[model samples]
Target: MNLDLLLEQVRSTSLLEWIAVTFGVSEVLLAKRNKVWLYPTGIISICCGAIVLIQAKLYAETILNAYYLGMSIYGWIKWKSRNQFGTPKITSSDSMDKVKTWGIVLIGWVVLYLFLINFTDSDVPIIDSLVSSTAWAGMWLLANRKVENWIWLNISNAIAIPLLFYKGLFMFGLLTVFLFVIAVLGYFDWRKILKEENNELQSV
Candidate 1:
């Protein structure tokens, strides 16, 4: 893409896209810091993102964002239920939770893939469904502060970067790059926190 054309595209960007990108960045950074505010920020981002994806004819993505809105609210409530110390509890997923997480991913992928193929004109149904389903599973894990959420989220971010770029959504594509890096850092940060918490429990 030409520099002038890219600049023109940026200038022509809609308010919703800008809002989505802004809140999206805030949400990821807050997540990295283990802040409770991430959910509300995510809700705002998803609301803007839903409109933008709808306008772009990305029906799967639009529906995913709508789901994200609900997930964000649920995550907020769940995260608010802190431990005795009034801190949000974090944990690693056990074997059963891991199995259930992957199961959700598989089922969501199939359902969305069929929905997109049968009901919509999505040109990239496979990628769309993959991203949406994995993200759904990731959000579920994230609500409970499971360490594996970062892994699944990064998977979605990696796919979303190229997908958004191909769709001419350069801003969101760049945002995904930022999200990808942050999620990696988040994994390490949360892992360290979990380890320290475990150590404290053992000492007690």
Candidate 2:
């Protein structure tokens, strides 16, 4: 698409879409810095996102956005829970976290794909389900403060970009692209933080 046409579509976006995109950007930026505030911002973003996806006939993403609302709440609570030193420290995934993450991805894909094929008039069931399934795994891991969450989120964002544009959600497609960049930065930043924390513990 031409720059002029893209700019026009952006200007023509609804107020709700603007809100969703704004908060969505904030959510990812805060998440990249490992802030607990990301969850609340994400809650606001996904609530609006759910409506936007519904209008675009992206049933899987709409459901995933709704699931994000609950996960945001759960993540907020979990992030606030304090350990002996402070709020729960960020860390890399362990064996069990990896297992559960994979389970969410596989099971989420199967169930969402079947639901879309049988119940919804969705034309992009495969890619749509892949987007949501990876996102589900990411959100679950994020609640546990796992560094690997960014990896899964970036995977979802990568798959979701073209699909969002194909559905004429140009604004959201752009947001996903921004999210992709942030998730990439978040992955490396979180890993660095984890290493620093581990070093501090060893020294203590």
Candidate 3:
């Protein structure tokens, strides 16, 4: 990679892409800390990202970001709900929940793949749909405070990093790498929390 060219690319990044990157990073960091503010930050990020992706002709990514915006709102409300202990709770997903979540991913991938293939001029429809579907399932699990969300999110990040870089969205690619690390940390953190919660309940 040419240093001068990389610097030029950085300098030439659009305002919307900058906003998307900024808030997207914030969203992941906040979520790692189990903060409620992640949802609003994510909403801002994806809205900006949608516009940037549309301009880049990543139509499936654009639609994925739109879905992200809606899921952000749903996540916000869901996370705000209180348990009987009058606190927000994080929990591990049950076996059946895991099965159902992956089922959604499979169905979503096929549907998105067909839609992008027929409706858009996307050159990487399969990869785009795979990323989008996994992300959609991950977002749903995250909203419900399921620890398995990190696994799904990491899968999406792995696929998206190369795709974003290939599309010349270097900044977004780097951001996704950052997000992948955060998701790994978040998985362990949430698992610890679940263990503590279980211990507390058992002692009662």
- Give the clashing pairs for model 1: none
lDDT at 22, model 1 = 99
**Candidate scoring better on TM-score of 1 and 3:** 3
lDDT of each: 0.90, 0.92, 0.91
List clashing residue pairs in candidate 3. Answer: none
User: Which candidate should be chosen as best, given lDDT against the real structure?
Assistant: 2
What RMSD does each model have against the real structure?
1.3, 0.9, 1.1
lDDT of 3 by residue, 35-63 (tens): 99999999999989998898888887888
Question: Taking the tens digit of each residue's C-alpha lDDT, what string does model 1 give over 1-204?
Answer: 899988987997888899999999999999999999999888989998888898777888888888788888888998887667876678999999999899989999999999999999999999999999999889989988999999999998888889998898878888899999999999999999999999998999
Candidate 1 residue runs with Cα over 4 Å from true position:
83-85
Native-to-model Cα distance after best TM-score fit, residue 172 in candidate 2, in Å:
0.4
- Sort by lDDT, best first: what order? 2, 3, 1
Ranking by TM-score: 2, 3, 1
Q: How close to the true structure is residue 84 of candidate 2, measured as C-alpha lDDT?
A: 83
